[model samples]
Target: MSLRSLFVDFNSYFASVEQHEDPSLRGRPVGVAPVAAETTSLIAASYEAKAFGVGTGTMVREARRRCPGIQIRVARPERYVVWHHRLMEAIDHAIPVGRVGSIDEVACELVGRQRRREVAEEIAQQVKNEVALAAPGGAIRCSIGIAPNDFLAKTASDMKKPDGLTVIELADLPHALHGLELRDLCGIGPSMEARLHEAGITTVAQLTAADKHRLRHAWGGIEGERMWGLLRGAWLPTAPTERGSIGHSHVLGPELRTPVGARAVLKKLLVKAAMRMRREEMLSGAMAVRIRFIGHDQRWERDLAFDPTDDSRELLRLLNGVLDSGNRRHPLPGPANATPLSVSVTLMRLVPRTQSSGSLFAPTQDTRRVDALVDRINNKFGYNKLYFGSMQLALEHDAAPMRIPFNRVPDTDSENEAGHDPLWLQSLNRFKAIAEGEHRRRERGGKGN
Candidate 1:
């Protein structure tokens, strides 16, 4: 009996979710952009759009030119996350879902006394049915790939798209993988492929047959063997158990040039990074804030140590101080010049809040009070509705993160008042019919007694 794994990958997950929610987008060439604009590129592209050479990271303009009928919608990370959670829950109901790789893809490990093939098909059918029911009136589909290992399962999943199922058995490895490019392997990224080519290893077969010593010389000891094993269908690398860091970075558009404008952008980035860190249930002991100038010649970066905080306000304050000091040291020589590059806020040294160090400066209670007030004002009226004076103009962009999916998250005040649990409700509703049957049985028993 051989071990078998099944990988179920949602097709063009974010774009598919959008299309599923909006039937009008079905069968059309649609692209999701980070922001709603002609300038923004495609963050996700549907299969219909991909047929026209439109893919993730493609500029909207180019996508349109390639497929003149392409429709572009801004990326809604919040809405997408909601659907992602729902889909994962659906899969969990069907089979043991392995760690989620990204917002869209998940691997499920098949177990039990039943045949692996039967289990894979049954689980795939269950997942398909669950998604269809949960996402009403929307078209959401997944492709299932069955293989002896995770690497092959992933490759099999990619073999078919827009509702596909591919199975790669151990015996079929040679033929199935023959003529395939080296880059098709999971770990062989562009950089690795380039290095392999430099070593005269142009194909997977060449890589598999290369001298272990020579390959080790090229790639480090562990990584070299890891690559070789993956090519031969061996799953040695275990899936990561926990998340490492939460960070966000973006290049400042033309409008964000002045010191004030830069600060506005920095605040938005900080709030975004902080919010994600909180959602992940993680806190940072140290943080890094960076800024780059127009020509890429001048750059400034600062790392600050704190008593482990995830509060947006505190993070923004530190970011402002860093920016202030950088500007003072590297004064733009004149007001006419502007920095036209990127800003990033990275939260590092992640630790569970329980393990965080006690703040020497202030009590946690006081900090929570301030965060509550800020969260309240932002949730009630709108994000940045009452911001630290630096972000007046930054709030004007309708595509800003806070404004885009404001309706998705629970309102702070309303949640405090009602105490209703949406997640719990969803869980109960999932098995309502089963519970109803039990209730009927109890009623009959009572009547008979």
Candidate 2:
């Protein structure tokens, strides 16, 4: 009910960072993308570029047509990660972060009620300054919003951008929400907005005033009530916490086909996912694999429990079985008849290894040593210095497939010089201690209190 949350959004982030350090690009419309491939779309655009209607997912060719003389550059992934790490440290200096949405957005739950707005604004400005200094040749700014909950905070942040500080006080609720479009809110994208318009709810105000029963009927139940409450500046009841899960789903491109090709793609994805889970120091109690055959209009899914582990090879073996189960039970239409459109994997029922049992035969020692060796190689040189065999040709086949990025490793020289609270790494030795303490506490009968 009270405004005790802060949402931080980087301002025209990638392009701003580019322009801030280089005054030459200050007034130019700029776009940052992963690859220069003709098929790749713009990932981030400057405020000047956005004014000309350029946005993420806008095709590079169309963006050029929209704004002639626009500057486009491939993003420096390593530098961006360093900037993100610095910003994260700056934010945590002000408030404990509750959730990190992406490289450019973070949410914080204010511990104390008094001075929430003042603290949030100060933190936002500090972050802007710190990121600009930490990221060389990078100029970045952020807009922040302080409100009662995540939805409102995010909405308030987006209401205005590029150095915006919009606050949504409880008293400003229903009236402030009047003319806002459905898509202006976070979850409702273009498709949902179209559906809402067809249902005769065209504005946020209208949605709030509509009948709950009718809204539920049209919007398919819980989502209707959620939208209504959000528009009224009401907070959803907080749920109990549980172990976090990691999952990813990707639809195959035109080039990927055949059962052999599909299996290879699945193995590659699973390996990457397993490595991420291992880095988090967590294990999965169950796994799920799903396949969608759009051309045949068919879907197949399988889930199974397993001894907790983060072994990539083992996960690949399990993935094979999960897919085989689906195929044996209800075979997908032939590859000729159906395109294997989508493959998804879920590492569900996650729990800390200290709390869950792992496979007795698991190669923990060998994998741990390999992970350490990989870390050493990456820190000394850069990411992908050593990689799984499945991903060796990633760069050759897919120009921009997300691989192990260089900035994933903590900065060693800076950490050594500054002893953990480096101006660059922006982390402290105490954080690791605290994390270990929490892990030990969880091992006991009680979770961290």
Candidate 3:
């Protein structure tokens, strides 16, 4: 067997980007919270913070108890997106990037002489050097793994820590992975571990020893058979995937934890999803709204099917109707009555614009054309500069992250929050002058058409 993959996984990507952007944060214990609130969970923690028993999913209050001096900052996703694209460009210069696993991880295929152990190690070092030089403050770091396949390479990458490199030759085989827990493998979660345990495979050694038929029986399908091959470094094609939905969710601050606030935020999220769907030249046939309350598992939700449409106005109207019908039965409580912690909206059952049939009851041609026009204007000037009035409360609160789909970096124009200088993002933005008076009116509190 020969080496076929080199994987790079950035360490504490969110916190590291914070330190990279701010010179004062270097070599400090840092935690990144979605909001600057104590109850919020930490999304990323620096190595120093991790050493102090503070890490991802550690609540801000608990982090302070563990590391009193930890510098917990609110996440700035727009800046992170900028860094993600820059690193991608820099790494592609060193080696052709194969699969961008996520914003913080990438896999590259090795060919020819590059598959040699020493050559692969040298290439890994080149990636490290390029990232260090390209990053602004040289604060970001990564762990690299060289192995015979993508899954194994990713697994090997997780075996080490910040700035460490590991190689797994095919000769190492199942022995090299025996020490890892069932969950340590890329796709094995608690549920999968339970299923494997039920199948009498209690350990990685047993998992590797099991026949394809037994593993398939345990997995309930061919995925198990596929995993059986993947364990021994078989080159298998990844399953094909397609976009099923477009959506966004946000954890609310104290002030916005109300029924009114949730409605406003959902409106904004739906608009954002609509814009993204249109960008993909797709129409949505369904819409789902969800409201998760504070400290509870119960949720208020609705999923409605609709005629395919990409018009933002039609989507907004559908959202309003859903909420209205639900409210008549069981009214959403206000902040004084009950706390609404978070809200989400999704557009589903998507079909390409070319495939959508004309809706007889839908509005004139300008309905869809106006949405495209508004999107272009916002991209040119700034996000929310000409948005619908329903998003007013959300704009005032100003809370949404661009890390919804991990692999898709923000366009950094209309997809980003306002008040940032997105001039450096010419790839997605072209500054154009819109009609001055109408945009100013929209900003001045007009319910835009």
Clashes of each: 0, 2, 0
Which is the leading candidate under lDDT?
3
lDDT of 1 by residue, 1-449 (tens): 23367788888877888898788999898988665555445667898999999887676777899999988987655566567778888888887778555556677776674236666777777878887788866467888787777778888888877678887776776578766788787767767888888888897677767766768766867678665666566766474446565554554444655566666767776775575566556777788876655433345677888777877777777776666663475432222364434555678888887787646753368777776677667556755565655556665653134321111232234332110122222222222222223334444567679
Candidate models: Cα lDDT each: 0.64, 0.63, 0.77
Q: Show the colliding residue pairs in model 2.
A: 16-139, 17-139
Residues 128-198, model 2: lDDT tens digits:
56655555454567788877777888888888876678888788876766767777787776668787888
Which wins on TM-score, candidate 1 or candidate 2? 1
lDDT of 2 at 36: 63
Residue 28's lDDT in candidate 3: 94
Candidate 3 residue 150 C-alpha distance from true site, Å: 1.1
Any residue pairs clashing in model 1, and if so which? none
Among all candidates shown, the one with the greatest TM-score:
3
In angstroms, give how far residue 424 of model 2 lies from its true place: 19
TM-score of each: 0.74, 0.68, 0.87
Specify the poorest-scoring 10-residue window by lDDT in model 1: 417-426
> Which regions of candidate 2 fall more than 4 Å away from where they truly are?
1-3, 21-23, 89-99, 108-139, 190-200, 210-229, 235-244, 248-265, 285-309, 320-344, 351-388, 395-449
